[model samples]
Target: MNGIKNAVFTDKSIRLLGKNQYTFNVESGSTRTEIKQWVELFFGVKVIAMNSHRLPIKVKGRRVRSIKGHKKHYKRMIITLQPGYSIPPLRKKRKELELKNTK
Candidate 1:
C-alpha cells in the first residue's frame, strides 16, 4: 500500500507544476526522508529535494452556540524531481485540454 496520497491539485500546487515540483497529502507521522523515498519509488523519478508543511487546525465558529472544533490537521509535502522527470497526471490533463482547444 502507498503511504502517500495523490498530488494535491490546488491553485498553489498548479503554480508550482512548471518548476517540476509536486504536492501530496501524507500521513501526519510520515517523515521527510520517508516521503522522499516514497516519491522516488512510486513515480520512478529522482527526488531532488522535499519540504513538508503541517497545516494548522482552524478553530471553528463562536464560543457560544456554534460548532466548536478545529479542522482536521494534516501534513503536505512538496517534492521537487530531477530534471526531465515529471508527474504525468499533473501535465497529462492539461495537455489533453490544450489539444482539445486546438482542434
Candidate 2:
C-alpha cells in the first residue's frame, strides 16, 4: 500500500463496462504505478493491470486574449482486477436483509 492511497476517490469515479473497471479524476502527471496503487487501496481490490490516457488541455475562451488561461489537463486510469473478486454494487437494495446486533 506504499504507493497506493493517494485520494479516497470522488463522485466522478464512473464505472466503465461491467468488469470492475472505474474511471478516476487523476492528476495531470500521475504515473501508472501511482495510479494503480491509489485505486487498489481505495477500492480494496487487487489491481491486475493499469492503463492511462492524457487528455488535451481545454481552452475556455475562443480567443486567448479573452480568457486569462485554459483549463487544466487530466489523466485517466483504467484498472483491471483478478478473478473471483468484483466490486460491490453502487446501489443498495432496500429489501435485502439488514444485519442487526444479533450478538
Candidate 3:
C-alpha cells in the first residue's frame, strides 16, 4: 500500500527477522492501525504488536547563503507478527535474480 514505503534491511533489522519481526519505512501520516490493516491484507500475516518512531530530521545549508532545507521526514515501524508467520524477502532476492539473469 501507499502507506508503506519499503522494507528496511539494515543489520539491526535483519537480526530482528529471526525474531519474527519486520521493519519498514512508512509514511509519516500513517497510523498504527492503518499500517496493521494494510500489512495483514497485503501480506496475510497477523500483526501482534507494532512500534513506531519518527526519524530525526536532517537539515542542509550552504555556507555562502542563509538558505536551509530539510529532508523529507518519515516514520519507521517495527512490526512483530504472530509465530509461524513471516514476510518474504523483498529487495535482496530480486537483485540476486536480476544478477543471475544478466550473467
Best by TM-score: 1
Please list the residue runs of candidate 1 whose C-alpha ends up more than 4 Å from where it truly belongs after superposition. Answer: 61-73, 94-103
Q: Give the top-scoring candidate (lDDT).
A: 3
lDDT of 1 at 56: 57
lDDT of each: 0.75, 0.53, 0.80
Model 2 lDDT per residue over 13-102, tens place? 332434555555577666787777776676677888777765454355433333356544556666667766555643121112122212
Question: Where does candidate 2 clash, by residue pair?
Answer: 4-37, 4-38
Backbone clash count for every predicted candidate, in the order shown: 0, 2, 0
Q: Between candidates 2 and 3, name the one with more favorable TM-score.
A: 3
Of models 1 and 3, which has the larger lDDT? 3
Model 1 RMSD in angstroms? 4.7
Better candidate number, 2 or 3, judged by lDDT: 3
For candidate 3, lDDT tens digit of each residue in 1-103? 8899988867677668778888999998898999999999999999999999876553453233222564445799999999988777653544565567679
TM-score, every prediction: 0.75, 0.52, 0.74
Cα deviation of 44 in candidate 2 (Å)? 1.4
